[model samples]
Target: MLAVELNGDAVRAKNGSMVAYDGRMGFKRLTGGGEGLRGMVTRRVTGEHMTVMEVKGQGTCYFADRASNINLVRLGGEKLYVEASNLLCTEEGLRTGTTFTGLRGAAEGNGLFTTTVHGTGWAALMSDGPAVILRVAPGLPLTVDPGAYVAHTGELKQQFVSGVTWRTAIGEGSGEGVQLRFEGSGTVYVQPSERTTLGGQL
Candidate 1:
């Protein structure tokens, strides 16, 4: 099978559902249950319904039929999130967390979540994926703001560390150093260009 990609960034997702998506999204249609279906589905029957662009070379796809929007959040290093807003389905191998728990004072921005991959596996996010991917190696350092990351893979751990606040203070706000931190070795895929959700700004 090829890497999953959605023509548009959105499809529908249900409770207990999961799928990899790409590009921006439009309206998502639902089935018998709605948001209240989580108890019944347990994130199983949901994933993004792809548009035309993302499925150009792909076929035999998976889809989630309940979720509305999902975004790819970028944290520094190997950290990223399949943002709840833009998230369709995540694999059972990875871990997810709220972006606020780590730092209350700083790193307090909207449109960000925290996720980490434990082992080497594949996870898909909504985007046309940059034509090229950034390969992370020892001595090669990369830092992405919370709102800039898409998805990452390989052996890695995500920690909310002391960067969000310090970085925020640099501008003229309170000092709270809480950022989604990734420490380990891996690769991160980010689209130099991204699509903002409803507000149109990340």
Candidate 2:
């Protein structure tokens, strides 16, 4: 469960995620994840669907979804790239949109576009377990399994790497056949457990 304290401020959260609240609070369903008509149209066209609600007023609100573990991320004028299903909540000042992720998204079975959040504020992400934060530097790159990926922050370049060979295709190779390679300066969030991704079945 995640607790958010609002003092005359508003926050955007996943619709139907609120479990409890105290004091005066208003919950309004946001059309198109609160990005307005263009954003709604973009989401529809990209296949990255997100249903959001705006929570406002002075009070503490609680949120939970499928009993998933929640991770809080503080952003200071940086962009966050995350899956729509993994994102839980964000401060009202943040801007939500979609970006092309190429083959990485296809490996996860989430399509070619992923959700993006920008601005200075806090956002919450959901994971199968407590998320692990990995740092990437100039020379030190990081590779992650598609099923365990949660979200990433900062400027990072991502590449889809396939270790699949003829042996793998014939079921005589390592299970770790595909991966997402990340380089540059950034931080990645991964879960301890892997989800049922297309890459995981390979």
Candidate 3:
């Protein structure tokens, strides 16, 4: 569960994520994740659908989804790339949109686009287990499993790597053949457990 304190300020959260609240609060569903008609149309076309609600009041509001563990991230003019299902909440001042991720998204079974959040604020990300933050530097690149990816911050380049060979195509190779390779400078949030992704067993 995530607790957010609001003092005349507002926040955008996943719809129906409010489990409890204290003091006076109002919840209004935001169409197309509050990006307006253009965003709605973009989401529909890209298949990155997100239903969000605005929570405004002077109290502490609690949010949770499927009892998943929450990770708090503070962004200072940086961008966060995450899957729509893993994002829980964000400050109202932040901007949210969808961006194409190409093969990486296809391998994760999350379609060809992913959600992007930017600006200086706080955002809550959900994962099956406690999230692990890994850093990617200039010389030190990071490779990750698509099923374990949660979100990432900073400037980084993501590449789809295939380890599948003739042996894997047959039956002698390891199940873990595809991977997401990250290079540059950024931090990646990964879950301890893997989700059921298209490349999980490939």
- Per-candidate TM vs. native? 0.38, 0.98, 0.98
Off by over 4 Å in 2: none
When summed lDDT is taken over every stretch of 10 residues in candidate 2, the lowest stretch is: 168-177
| Residue-by-residue lDDT tens digits, candidate 3, 71-164 | 9999999999999999999998899999999999999999999999999999999999999999999999999999999999988999988888
C-alpha RMSD (angstroms) for model 2: 0.7
Model 2 C-alpha lDDT per residue in residues 18-69, reported as the tens digit of each score: 9999989999999999998999999999999999999999989999999999
- C-alpha lDDT (0 to 100) for residue 5 of candidate 2: 93
Full candidate order by TM-score, most accurate first: 3, 2, 1
Number of clashing residue pairs, candidate 3: 0
